[model samples]
Target: MAMIEDAGRRRALRTLTAGALAAGGGLLSVRAFAGGLATVNMQLGWVPGGNQVGEVVAKRLGYYEKEGIDFHIQPGGPNIDGVAIVASGRFQTGEISSSPSIMLAVSEGLPIKCIAVGLQQHPYTFFSLKKAPIRSPQDMIGKRIGIQSTGMVLLRALLAKHKIPENQVKIVPIGADMMPLVAGQVDAVTGWQTNTTALKPLGADRVDLRLWDTGVRLYALPYYATTSMLKEHPETVQGFLRATARGWMYANQNRDQAIDMLVKDYPNLNRADERVAIDSLMHYAFDQTTQTQGWGAMDAAVWEEQIAMYGQLGQFRAAQPKVDDVMTLDVLKATHSSRLKV
Candidate 1:
C-alpha cells in the first residue's frame, strides 16, 4: 500500500517538475514527424491494461499506419513521469488517469493542453459491502472511507458537493485494493469501477458510489500534448485522434477481436480478467453522448465545472486556468465527420 501511494506521489512530483520547468524556463519543441511517417509516442500515466484496449486494437489492425502515424505506446510506471516526458518534448503525447491532472498541470503553467477525452465520464468510484452499504455521498457520513492519500481531493469534492461535514466521515489511508475493506479495516474503498480484476475480491456484496454521479463530473483518460505541438502541427493531432477514434469504434463493435489483439500485444495481462473488464471499461468509454458526438467527445462546459470545483477545493495554488487553457476542442471539431461515423 505504501509503495503504491509513494508511486503516485512520485508521479505527481514529476508532473509538478515539468510544470515548474515550463513556467520558469521553457520546454523543448520536438518535431511532429519522423522520416516519412508522423511518429507519436503516447505516454500513459500507469501500466498499460484494459484501459488501452482501443489503442492496442488500433495498432494491431494497422489503423495508425494507415493514418500515416508510427504510433508507440510508452507504458508509465511509478518511476516514469509520463506528463513530464511529454512536457519535455521527449514524447509526442500523453494520457493521464483523470481530468484534474490536466487542470492542475495547466494551472502551474505547464506547456500542454488536453485535446480529447477517452472516457466521457470518470469511472472512479467508492466501493463498499452490501452489509454496510455506502450507495451515496450522504451514506459516507460516519463510515470509515479507505482511499489513497492522493485521492483525498476526490473525497473532499464528494463531501463538499453533498454538504457533508468533513469531520463526519473518517478517512482511512489505504492502497488501491479491496483488502482493507474486506478485513473490516474500513467500511469502503476507492478505485475505478472498470477494473474488474481489482473489484473481484469484493464479490457480489460490492456497492458502488461513483464520483461523477455525485455531481463532481470529471473526464478520465484525457489525451494531452504540448502547446507547441498544437500550434505547430494541428494536422498531426487530428490524424492521431481520427485513427484512435476508429480504434475505439472497432473495439466497441467487435469485442472478441479487440480482446485478442489486446492480450496478444501485452502478454502479461490475464485474458479472462481483461475480457470481463472490457465490458465495464467500454460502458464508460461510449455512452449516449458518444453515440451522437462520437468517441473522445468532451464538453467545454464540463471542463469549466471541474475547474470551478477544483478551485473551490483550493487545488490550484497558481492562477486558476481557464477552460480553454486546459483543453481545446479544435481537434475534435476538425475530425467531427469521421468521429461521428465512429
Candidate 2:
C-alpha cells in the first residue's frame, strides 16, 4: 500500500493497533496467528450486538474453523477509527456501519475497497411521532429535523435527492436521543431503523421515513479490506467470504439457534431483545434481491447512485472516486455458489 500521508491518522491507527493487541488478550496475525489458520480480525464500526449474530454463530459453530480460518471480531466504539485501522494494515479487514463511509474514505485517498455488503438496503430512517408526522420529504418542510452533526450529510442527500431547498427544513443539531422528538423539541430524529434498543423510546406511534425511500439509497454493514490485502491474498479473502456467507445463510434459515449462539458469545446482550430485533435485522439482510441473488448481494448501480449523490452534495473532499475504487465484485463473484445457496 502507498504511504498514508496523514500523520495524525497514522499515529491514531498505530495507537489503536497497540491497544487492540493489549485489550484483545495478545497480538493477532492472519496467516500465523493461531495453529496456522488464516486469521482475520474484523474490526467493527460499533460495539458487538445483534448486528453480529451471524459472525457469532459462525465462530460458535466452527464455520471459520471448517475453512481453516481464525476470525476475531474487534469492537469499535465512538472513539474507534475503524477505517483508519483497516487502511493502516492493522487489521486484515473491517466492517463499517454504512456504505457511504467507504466512499468517503476512498475520496480521502484511503486504500481500501468494500468487498461485500452485509445489508442490501440501509436501515437509516427519519423518525417522527404520529402527531406531527413527516412521512415524506415534503413533510420535512418547515419542520425542525433533529439529527447529529455527523448525519447532516444524510439529511442533505435526502433534500438534494428530492430537490428540496435546504432552508425549507429546520436543521436541529441534537444527540442520538428520542427525548428531543418526544418532548416536541423537534419533528423527527435520525437513526437506524434496526436499532430497536434505541428506538424503544419512540413508542409504537412513531412514523418512519426511511432514507432509502427518500431516494438517498445506501448500503449498511459493508465489509472492506485494504487494497494490498486483496492483491496479496486473493484466496484468503475468498475463503473469508465463503465462510461468512455460510454463517449468514445459516442465521437466516435458523433464527432461534442463531440468536441463542449470539447471546452465548456476548453475554452482555439480552436474549429477549436480540430475539425480537433479529426479525428486523433479517428483513434488511434478506430481501427480494437476496432471494434471487443470495446473501451478501449488492448492485453496482446502487453504488454508482450513491457516489453521484454524495459527489453532487460536495461530500467528497478529494476527487470523486470511481465505482471500482469504492468496491469490488471479485470476492462476491468468487463465492457465488456458496452465497447463492440461500
Candidate 3:
C-alpha cells in the first residue's frame, strides 16, 4: 500500500507551498462539538485496512470518546496528498505509512513533526524462496531482486549500509505482485512481512530479510502533526496517543475480540486475514524497547541514524533536516504512564 507509492508521494509533498498552506487556516482550529468533544481527524497516505486496526478498535470501543476526542479517519489514495493536507492544517493529525515521508517533507520546509510512531521497526523485507534464500543483505548480490519503483531507494540504502555496489544485483521493477518471484523472473520480491494474505502464495519456503535488521533503520505508521498543532494543542495530542496506545495494547492481549471489532467497524475487511495479520503486526509494535518505554516510544538516536542514512543517500532535495525538525517526544513523554507496557 503506502510503502509502494512513497516515491511519487514524496514528489507530491514537495509541491506544497507556504501560500497554499496558509489558505487552509480557516479549517485549522480544533473544532469542538456540542458535547465539548474536540474533533481530531487523522489523515492517512493509504486506504484503511489492517494497518489501522488499533484506531478502528479504539473508535469502536469508545476510547477516543473517553479521551474527549471526536476522532475520525480521512482516507487517502494515489491522488491524495495526505502530508500536504496535514501540513496545511486541514487535518489536526496524520499518520503516514513510512517514516521517510515525514523526514523528506520536513526537509522541504513542511511544518509537520512526528509525535509518535506506531511500529517501532519497519516491517518492510526482502522475500525469497528457501531454495535460493536471501537471508542477509550480502546474499542479495548476483540475484534478480523484484522491487516496486518507489522501493528502489530502500534497496539502495540497504546496499549502501552493507557497502555493496549497486551493480552487483539486478534490480527488476515490478508491480505489487509476488508472481515474478514465483515464476523465476526474479529471485526475490519486496513487501511488508505483516501482509499475510499477500505472502500466502510464497508458502512455508519463504525467507525474510527485514529492512531494520539490515541497519537501514526506519519507523512505520508514524503519527505526526503540524508544529502549530503540537504547540497549541499538546493536551489533545497526548489524549490521542494515550487512547491509541491502550487500543493497541488491548488488541495485543485480546486478538480475536479486536479483529471482531475491527471487521464490524469496517465490513470490507476480512476478519480471518486481519486476525492472521495482527500477530505479525504486534511483534513489530511491542518489543524489548516498548516493554520499558511503553508503546509509541522512540529514541532520538534512531531518528538521527535515519536522518544521517537518508542524507548520505542524497534523498533530501533541500536543506538537510535536523532530528528536532523531524520528530518531537513531548507528546510521548506526556502519555508514558497512560500507555500499557508488555
Candidate 4:
C-alpha cells in the first residue's frame, strides 16, 4: 500500500469541519473558493523530491497561475497524515506514493477518489547482486528477502501471485537502507528504481525484478481529491490536470532545463542526483498509452485488476471496494484536449 517511511501511521477518518462548509442559499455547501482564484493546496504522502518535478515545473513556469489556481504543496513526512488532512477538507487535493493506498482508504470509508495516475507502471522492485540474483519470483525461494514492514503486504502479494508458499522464503524486516544487502545480511532488498542516489551503492552488479513483472500490477504516484470537491467543482480539477500535464510534457522534452527548474524550486535537492533520477522517472510517467491518450492517462481495467488482486490478498478491512469507489475518469475526459499530447 503506502511505500513511504510513515506507512505505519493509522488512517483515521477525519470529518469535514464548519470552516470547509460554505453557506449558499441558506444551505451549507462545499465550494471551491469564496472569491478570486481558487487555491489548490496539494498534500503529499512523502517529502517532495524528484517525484514532484512536474508539479514544480508547472508552479515555476506559472502554468497553475495561468489556470487561475493559487497552487501550493504541503510536504508530508513520518509525522504527517496527508490523506486524513485532505479528507478533512483542509486541502483541496493529494498525491500518494502508491495506488492501493487509495483503495484501502476507500474500503475503510475515506471520502477520497483517485483522479489521475502519474506513473503508468509501478517502479517498486527487488534488487540483488548478480552473484546471488533474484531474477524472478521463483528465485526468492529459500533466500533472505529484506523489506520494510509496511511493504510486507506487497511481498505477500508477490508470493501469492506466483503461487509460492510464504513459508518457502525468509522475510527480514529492514528499514529503507540498502546496506542489508551490501553487508550480506539479506540476499535482496526492495526499493523504487527511480531512487538513483540510494541504488548507487549497489553498483553495476545489481539485478532488478520489478513487482509489476511478477503480475502484482500496482500504480505509483496517483493524484486524488475529496469526493465533495470532485462533485462540486470538477472544472477546478480539470484545470489542475491540464496544467500539470503540460509540465510533464515539457519535462519529457527538456530534461536538462526541467532538472534545473526542479532543483531551483527545492534548493536542498542535488542537481546531479535528480538529473539522473528524472531519466528513470520519465520512463514510468510516459508510455504507449500516454502517447495516444495524452499525459495523466489511466485505464479502468488496470484499476479493476488492482482491486481484484488486493481483495484476493485480504488487504481490505471491510468489504472490497468497487473501482468506481476508488477512482473516476471524468476529469481526465474533460481535460483530454488540454492535456499535452506526447
lDDT winner: 3
Q: lDDT for model 1, on a 0 to 1 scale?
A: 0.85
- On TM-score, the leading prediction is 3
Order of candidate numbers by TM-score, starting with the best: 3, 4, 2, 1
> Which residue pairs overlap in candidate 4's backbone?
none
Report model 4's TM-score to 2 decimal places.
0.92
lDDT per residue (tens digit) for residues 171-245 in model 3:
999999899999999999999999999999999999999999988889999999999899888888898898889
- How far is each candidate from the true structure, as Cα RMSD in Å? 4.0, 4.2, 2.9, 3.2
* Model with the higher TM-score, candidate 1 or 4: 4
Between prediction 2 and prediction 3, the one with superior TM-score is: 3
Model 2 residue 235 lDDT score: 84
What is the TM-score (0 to 1) of candidate 3? 0.93
lDDT of 1 by residue, 158-197 (tens): 8988899999999989887899999999999999988899
lDDT of each: 0.85, 0.85, 0.87, 0.86
Worst 10 residues of 4 by lDDT: 22-31
Scanning candidate 3 in windows of ten residues, the lowest lDDT window is 1-10
How do the residues 1-342 of candidate 2 rate in per-residue lDDT, one tens digit apiece?
011123555587667667766776333235655887888889998999899988887788888888888999999998788898887677889998989889888887778999999998999999999999989999999999999877888888888788899999999999987889988999999898888888998889999999998888999999999888898888888888888888888998899999999988899998888888888999999889887777898899999999998888777767899999999999988888888773
Output the lDDT of residue 6, model 3.
Answer: 37
Tens-place lDDT digits, model 4, residues 6-64? 22334243233443454222111224553567789899999999999899889889898
